[model samples]
Target: MQYLHALETAIIYIEAHLDEDIGLEDVARETGYSYYHMTRLFKSAVGETVGSYINKRRLSNAAKELLYTENRIIDIAIYNGYESSEAFSRAFKDIYRISPLEYRKNKHDFFIGSKKGLNIDMLKHITNSITLEPTIANFKETKIVGIRGEVALKGNGLSCLWEQFHRIYAAIPHTVPNRRDFCVCETNQTTYKKNGDAIYSEMIGTEVDSFEEMPDFVVNKTVKPGKYAVFTHMGSLANLEKTYDYIWGTWSLSTKEELDNREDFELYTEQFYSMDNPDNRIKIYIPVC
Candidate 1:
């Protein structure tokens, strides 16, 4: 938990220096943590080393700059903390799979007035209080229309998934539940990326009983059944992410029951009518053995 506080402080430093040179020592100093401990904490809480995380982020931002600004590639590279154009190009290609010149030519990963940026500001102050209860349950196999994509803990991965859900749902006609949305994290065992990345968050809606054709989206064939460690998260969806860290980072470390090898899910039992209400709760079901 203290490490979590340190992480929050480190993220604030990262956000403050996104456009400047930010090294591990600087982050450690700013966060009041030793460099070794800071690296350990960041890796434990966020999955990647601090250097790798900062490099990837700078490269991601550089990609956006390539698309948004007509600034020279060298300038963009230097602005994002890269030593030289060659170094920046190598790093950019590693993350985005394209060079700055080609990226601009294709107009890829850019938009007009798109503040499509990721902020690590909230990582440090994540409110994480969760109670996990063990129970055995059976869930009826349900079919849903949803968009599926790999998501990272960093960036607007969850927000983008919801955006896709709305876009796909707008094209379909059904009596979908509006307030209680279903977000199922696909099993990490079968589909997780090599870096122990977070599972995909699918924005889903139950298929109408009489819908003649399934929409362009794939039918998510998943069954929610088994023993689980259920945790209820209350408050805004934006803040629900910290709840996940608690489940994975804190609860799992302190619990007797091991996390089950089944798909975990979030049930939005109630909508956030007001952002200030403390009684609103969302249930998180983690399969446990």
Candidate 2:
């Protein structure tokens, strides 16, 4: 709780001075954590660098100003700690997919990329139960057969998918002795964009020795053999996305390893306790070249 309290302090400090020129160094100093410790802990727990969280908060605040006030865009930019309007526009367009003028002009279909500030409750849920660091593994090719469906980017879409899979689980034929299950994220890359703006396809399946006599509704997927960075998540399944945010947001970008672009999956073994149990263990495998 010592470090988590420090993280909470950092978030409060950032929120208190979103309009000020708050640097990572300043936040780290305020938290009384060393610069290295601050960055690493922030990355693991918040799923982003301190710099990133600050900028997003600034932009999120600036967005509200644009909508609610008649302030000049450049003035709003400076108020948000951006040096110039051009730099702010570039940063804003990267996440919101449009210029400030476009965002302000259209009252429809715009979004704030990072809306909420970090809180201690969220940090504890993300950090206390999981080993955020990952181990690299050379995984073997495997096959699975299960139900697949379109799931929304938010909410309990996954629970419904898993329910359908479990109902048909006993009917599957030629299963391997390993009872481990795979919750594979089969995102359709063509329509996919960052920040939950595309159709999400997911599959829940178990390893199978053969695909013979499989039900027509169920399709088979092949997980190609390759190197992967395996991360272990423990605790309630509700906190699972926090772990993914850390992987995709901070770790994947900061690591020296190259992403292999293969299908990544959640591996559920016998060690998995009930979904609500804090002892639940689920392994996440991300392909790396």
Candidate 3:
């Protein structure tokens, strides 16, 4: 969404309210965008939801108090908006994986998630690389067989997995001739590292006509029929992150379409032969409601 004005206003509003309880409606009122629009713009541009960002800010502050000052943990908890020390400890453990008492005793110097303030450079990098509007189309059900493993959101270590997959792909019986191979990612919404890195279960494989004669090491999957927003990722795979930021962070925000909870995948065809070629391109399918 090119609503840069509204997005800018939102960052200002959020920074001002970091010390207190912040809400989407409050930010919307101050920024002049509707609740729905403000929510989308803030998350898309900033890469996080308003509530989660606010929580991180407060927790970061509370952590400082635990390390430097001799303030009581209960007092620090209340200052950060927790009603009780137990509640605060629970939240603290969820992020830091340590109790407040243990954290204070150890006196660990720490930093919460780094996403804060408006990233002007990152936002400006979304050049005319990808299509502004995605092609909305219905996808047919396809059967897949591949090796699966957990991969980090950043620096997706999928090359080795894909290489191993190729060894088995040719031997699989009754393979689809014209269909494109898929790199499927199943994201975990509730789990994240302390530094905010996401871990997703990814599978890289090609379409198969039947489950019979499938290798024991590979698991089979069926992508259900649904509508998706298909965007083209132009250039080498190195810049796919920028294209995705624009798709999930910008285009999806500006559009009135809603996304559904379904498997999203990358389509690999002959264009992918040159993995690092500047002219290479691929289509990414995101399930939408």
Candidate 4:
């Protein structure tokens, strides 16, 4: 578990410093793991070399800037840590199959995939099967007390954090009623890096009336009152990523609603029997304006 936590911390460090000149040694030192051990763990867990991940993320962000911003290609390249425009263009064309200028001219389709391109057909199928109509609910400000950590948005860090939280939840004091667990993703500040990799502060805890008497190890947080687009995720927790992909990639993009800078969270109700259960249902709430 400690190794897993260290790996996640390394991922966050990499994401937070992608625009800077970073390397494996920097990540290893940040996470307090040896260079060889960190490399092996990252490869095993993330299924990609650290250098490859960084390159792909840089290219992905550069593509986004090309489509969204009017910055010159050379400037965008430099901003993304490329030494030269020629090198940046070469890498961009390698992934996008088009020159930066050409992509900007015909910026109709946005590529949001990894080195392995996204399967649009599969995404459509998943979106079609799930009903994502959100219910508008006004929630009062709520307090949560639990252990918190930084997790990489792309890898298994979030899931692993949840597992660790569950293991130690019994030790925490002042938990609330109905066995309702809150998996909160803090997005109000510095949630994502330029490379589209996120360093989210996640907490797995229960609601509390106040934080006055919280234990020393537990962290206290507040969820502000707002209108939320509440969507239900009915399936195993493992497949929750598919639902998220659809929501962020397809639905949110198309919707007219503007998302607010608040913490999005998962409400694990009584129906959530266990992580592996097929029938476990969780409610996802996204703060929206």
lDDT per residue as tens, model 4, 1-289: 4665676677677778879999888888998889898889766544455676677767767777886789999999999999999999888776666788998897633323333222433333253334556788998888877778887767778778887777777766666677767888765443545455667678888777667766677787787889988888776776776767656644454356877867788988889887777677788888898
- Stretches of candidate 2 off by over 4 Å are 28-49, 52-80, 85-116, 189-199
TM-score of model number 1: 0.50
With a 3 Å backbone cut-off (N, CA, C), the pairs that clash in candidate 4 are: none
lDDT of 3: 0.72
**What TM-score number comes out for model 2?**
0.76
Off by over 4 Å in 1: 1-5, 18-21, 110-121, 124-204, 208-235, 238-289
Error of 1 at 286 (Å): 16
lDDT of 3 by residue, 36-98 (tens): 888887675555577866676677678778877899999999988888999999888866668
Candidate 2 local lDDT, 78-116, one digit each (tens) = 999989999999988866668888878864322226355
Ranked candidates (TM-score, high to low)? 2, 3, 4, 1
RMSD of 3: 8.4
Q: TM-score of every model?
A: 0.50, 0.76, 0.59, 0.58
Residue-level lDDT tens digits of model 1 in 151-267: 665556776776677667666555355534567776543233323243544545544433556665545544455676777776666666666654554345445776566777776
**For model 3, what is the alpha-carbon lDDT of residue 6?**
69
Candidate 4: stretches off by over 4 Å: 1-129, 188-196
How many residue pairs collide in each prediction?
A: 2, 0, 1, 0
The superposed Cα distance between candidate 2 and the true structure at residue 193, in angstroms, equals 9.8
Model 2 alpha-carbon miss at residue 24, Å: 3.8
What lDDT, from 0 to 1, does candidate 2 have? 0.79
List per-candidate RMSD values in Å: 10.6, 4.9, 8.4, 15.0
